[model samples]
Target chain A: MKPACKSCTKEHEKTNYLHMKQQIIEILTELRPEFDFTQDVDFIEAGMLDSFDVIMLVNTLDEKLGISIDGMDVVPENFSSAEKIEALLKKNGVK
Target chain B: MSLKFTYHNKRICGILTVLPQREVLFEEEMDNYNFSPAKSMKLKLAMGFNKHRIVDENTNVSDLAVFGINYLLNNQLIKKEDISALILVTQSPEHFLPATSNIIQGKADLGTDMLCMDINQGCGGFVIGLMQAYSLLEQQEIKKVLLINADVLSHKVSKRDRNSYPLVGDAACLTVVERSETPETIHAVVNMDGRGASAIQIPAGGFKMPGTPETAEVKEDENGNFRSLENLVMKGDEVFNFVQTKVPPMIEELLKIAGKTTDEIDYYFFHQPNKFMLNKLADKIGVPREKMPSNVVENFGNASGATIPTAVSFNLGDVALTHSYEVCFSGFGIGLTWAAIVQKLEKLKFNEIIYY
Candidate 1:
């Protein structure tokens, strides 16, 4: 087995990040279909998401993407929107 | 910390619960929480909460417990003299001075010779009360222990607070535990993390933070729930995370100590916070929906200390009285406490839910 070159590994990581964002959007939409995930960036402030919804989203991400979310990381901003959740995953080294 | 042990002689002989006559539907309270019709439906679907039974303002914890205990005595399921020890577990008691157990014992005329005490506990009250009762029974002199778990939390929460109001219902349960000639195996595991104490608590109205005129002034939270500092506040996300991550492993540890598997257990009665949370926990723990019930929250709301017994009464009340079962009970929340107990019940008389 040969190790992947640094450039190739970086390219794969970038692709993985994009895939995680798309998957996160899908999860949010499925969990609460009434809300438009693309337009609703301020989920908490807009009342589009409640505590129960956040928990479902957390479990879904862990189940679908294998992203282990610590209880401390379940803040308002991290779960505020699809883009924020994607960034949170990247910050936690999801890939 | 985690404590694991067994009770050899004590066995639950009978169980009874009392609920208030009043019922509150979610749709009626939509305006209180500023919830739209779609949002209300979403909450109902996700949380399995549509209606809750709450006691009126005048009713207190002692009222419900006494009513249930009187029913048990009147039906001849238990005699007043046969009760060797009385333990009342609740966060809401009749008075802060005299132990509520003493008051109940006095009201029931059980005599002062019987041991009576009160414990401050919340959602995990049933298992903890059972443990306490079994400990008293282990002393050998106590032949029968009456463990009363009650919480009239409806009085403590603000009706305007959707997070707390729709989730809490007032109720009380009296479980008669007696000494068995043949030792029955009962396994209990209690785990506590004080760091999460503030997750679900009343910030004021306690010895540490006594209530004042200022505390009585109602204020609206960011979520639109009107409450005072003395009222109950719950950080839902913290609690959900705690249960999802901590409870399943604790239950597995309980099964391991009992030298049994989930397959052997006949029923799993967990503290019913809501449908979504319970279903998620059932999936994480690998217990089927049939085995673990999620309707107590919908039917009775989260009655804190009384939740597990209420769950038992709602699901298995009729059949449990006539049949034998290998039962597992788990409760978590408030004190950031979580506990599980696995035991066997043989033809215990389970009475119907009384409306007081």
Candidate 2:
């Protein structure tokens, strides 16, 4: 059911980190149109985003991507942009 | 002024580092963590979080600090031996006795002789760390300061703690502040509440409550239970009321002190707390969305004290720091604390003069 990592035993993580980031941004944009979708917009002011969105995002990344994100790593700085979020996944060797 | 003499200077820097973070256990193709009913209804409703980062049990924050500081230093040609002061701020230290900064210095491959210490401020830690560096630099004792805001919120975090699960996010931030006569300087207004200190505090493992059966078994109200004891708890309405009433006035006072107006400042970075609060504050204070810098709440979930500097580092690339333009900042939360700092960003070339 999961593509386990030979070293860390993490699952098919990267495949989903990429897919969900776009999907979530699309979801967020549809929910709130005023946000500058071209770049990373502040969650609260953008209307559809908030703190819980990150949790949901982590869950989304996990369920869709299969990488178990460490709680300590789930910070705002990492998630500010699709680029940063994707970069974080790559830096961790998660994807 | 008798004579202008420059002494060995102390400055502060910041770095934000994070490790691999994902849920510990989850197996799903398209399932969403947001739909889980176990999470706090308010947390889910107010900001809409479902899954937050889960740092591994073995991973302490000092490692993250090392990663962050190394990354920041990799770009600049600076050696570790140049550092004079290092302040590590974290709620979770590597050990009960040894300061966490010592471990960070050891791992980051630094030379000996650093004034390393640990700070115990809950979330206002990063700002306090900045203030500490500022004081030292002003005294011209140390040459540089590393203000590391790193924390691992997993070991103490309860999976069953719905209230805190969505709210408390983790991260490591490092900032490098060097001595500058005409560089960006911070002017801050800081406040703390020791009376309401017990409002958000650890209930176990300390001299006051000493992790023993007789002392530990005392008062199982809403802490450390299977039902709702694991997560951080806050009287939201009380905290909200306090911030709304106090923060705006504080900003007004800070503006007066700096002799500037909302219109005069180039960039204003609020804590970027939540959508609801941001909306209210923006309306009340007249801080246009353009002036505010944030990648706020719903994005990274709340990185606690790391929010302010995180906003700056993430967004400042686009900001052209001109001599005429100045930056204004504010940080608030936990320990029921908040701070406002205003300063001018000076030119980077001020140090380059051909001396005879």
Candidate 3:
């Protein structure tokens, strides 16, 4: 198999990031179907996510994404929004 | 670091969980929380907080244990004379000096030939207590071990503390562990991290921080939950993370060591912190939701170390009385300690949940 060129690698990375972002949104929506996670709002501050929800989110992310999230990264901040959760997944070495 | 052990010819012959008669519904206490109705309801649904059994304010750990043991004795489920050792595991001992086990021994009037000792442990205490029972049975003179796990921790949790109050429950489980002539291999594993001790603890009332008036001063945490130093404080997120990150691997390791696959085990009677956590843990470990019943918390609250036995007696009481199953009992929390036991439970002489 030939290694990807620089432009090809960049394109692949962009696609992966977009796919990861979509997955995060779907997870957040599934967790609390009533909440609109697409909006750029703080889930924690808006009472959309509590500590228990954060733990559930982490568990789902770990299972769905096939990534082991660091316990230290399970704080409310990391799960306050889909964008933040996506960043957390990326930090955990997700594609 | 995991402490692994395998014991032979030991079995848990009986289990009786005594729950208080009083039941407090989560909706009744919803007004006590600092959150809105909708938010609190979400928490209630997520955490499986329906109702929990709590002892009267005047009750203590020894009281519950005495009641449970007396029930066992009166019903002839356990013979008092056969009990060679009395082991009481709890974080809510009646007195610091006399040892609650001795107090129970004296109150129950079990003969003086038995060894009475107390172990301070929380959720993981049941498995730890079983470990101790197995060790004691190793002695030639010892025959039956009366392992009582009781905690009236509801007394220690502030009613206003939304984080710990609604979930804390009081219950006692008296299990009779005895030597079995039938050959059996009981595999167990225990792992602890003291650094996470504060993850689930009552910060004061020990010698390190004696009970002072100031320690009893109720204060609000950042999350708006009210608690004092003397009350039980649980850092929920940290404990959840601990369970999620550590427990599945521990179970896998134990199954591996025991040369058994996940499907080989009949049931996973783990400590019921909450339904959500237990369900997540079951998912993580590939155990079916039905196999790992997480209804204990919703029904009787999280009874600390007693949860495992409570789970068994509550869910499998009728069937377990005459049937046999290869079960895995795991408990985690309060010492930041996690432990598991894999053994065959067969035809228990007594397996039921009685109300105090």
Candidate 4:
């Protein structure tokens, strides 16, 4: 019974992660609707996001998830993909 | 760490800014780079940049500064002898050997007893220049100091460098600081980090990497702007992060040190980088947009050291001279440097932007 409960908790956490990713996608789309976030994981590399866009994303994440991103976290590596952004959010105690 | 300083005896009496008459619209100029109209429109709308002033190739920062100083002297707004020290704050000097201030002294024909020096600074130069002027008053018998903040950044940027060229304007400002007996004090906070020095720099033309044939060879950057290492290059993301993360806290600390809150201040003048960045900063600091003038870059482009004085002279115009103001001035960039000054200005005789 304990093993089953652990499995259920793991599934729940996976669902939560998916929800956060969806929220991030929504934020990116709202900012620059012309780009497809799914296809372009290299958003930072492709020059899809300018400095203003990054600031807006940071502001939105703070407003939505109650997380503060610092200068260190603003690196292109952390913002290159939705998955990486989610990892950053988790590292900042978003969960 | 932050350095805090207070000055009780010095005050700025007047400010005059001069700009080149020639202008270039970004949309029209971007055609050479093949920057799409849609993208151009987006940048214009988002950055608040439409047109910028550019000087003729032959003109330098000294030409503009001399013109402004002569105007002040000729109009009898400030007498030549009243200036005990002349400070030229700029990175783009007329010559590397004789400091631009000394040459300007010769052209302005000031007395030999006067002190003249050029400070190699940009961006937050006005605040730094003002700080130096205040300190001089404390030491010497100086009664009035002529502070000239000027830069011709257009000459520093390459024509093919769309990222920087379109946003640079050429201008110079002359401000007169005199010893005053008023109780008003100037409060300043300054901070610097060499870690971010390379973020905005001309990689060559200095002693460390003297300009060579290869340095002048133009190559296209990933962003498509073509420029050599000899020209100015800015890591926009790093600068943006620095301004957003570091500057607001500095301003907050400055207000705390001054024993004033954001609301008590009448206007917050900033070194104009762009409308978007300034708006974001205002939101972060909770200063009202009305009090923050972010359009300096939009109308006149970023004149580096002269941005603040240019903003004041153009935005406030003569109205700044008519009333007592609790003004907060901040300049951040290029040295990866940021400085803020909070002071009170009473009636002033001159405040205007002149076109050359």
DockQ of each: 0.17, 0.03, 0.24, 0.17
TM-score of chain B of each: 0.97, 0.78, 0.98, 0.98
Per-residue lDDT tens digits of candidate 4, residues B171-276? 9999999888788888999998888899889999888999999999999987778899989998887887899888899999999999999999998999998876
Error of 4 at B202 (Å): 1.1
Q: Please tell me which predicted candidate would have the highest TM-score against the true structure.
A: 3
Candidate 1 lDDT, tens digit per residue, A1-95?
Answer: 33389888777877877787778878788877888877855988888877767766766676676645654566677888777888888776675
lDDT of 3 by residue, B1-356 (tens): 47999999999999999999999999999998897777677678767889999999898888888898889889888888899999999888887788889989999989999999999999999999999999999999997999999999999999988888888899999999999988999999999889998898888999999999999999998878898999988888788888988899999999998889999999999999988788778877988979999999999999899999999999998899789999999989987899999999877988998998
lDDT string for model 1 (B67-112, tens) is: 8888888888888878889999999988778988888888877866
- lDDT tens digits, residue span B1-356, model 2: 01111223323333343533554222221122323343344334444353444556677687667766676567563557678888887888778878888888888878677788898765667667777777766645677877777667656644444344444556676766677655444557887666666556555566665565553232323333232233345544345455666677777777777678988888777775554455445545667857775444454445566666655655653232323347776766677787776765443211110100
Ten residues in sequence with the least summed lDDT for candidate 1 chain B: B34-43
Docking quality category of candidate 4 according to DockQ thresholds: incorrect
The C-alpha stretches of model 4 lying farther than 4 A from their native spots are A1-35, A40-42, A46-79, A82-95
DockQ of 3: 0.24
Output per-candidate TM-scores for chain A, rounded to 2 decimals. Answer: 0.77, 0.55, 0.85, 0.87
Judge candidate 3 against the unseen true structure and give its global Cα lDDT, from 0 to 1: 0.88
**Better model by lDDT, 1 or 2?**
1
Best of the two (1, 3) by DockQ = 3
Candidate 1 structure lDDT: 0.84
- Worst 10-residue lDDT window for candidate 4 chain B reads B32-41
Alpha-carbon deviation at A51 in model 1, angstroms: 2.3
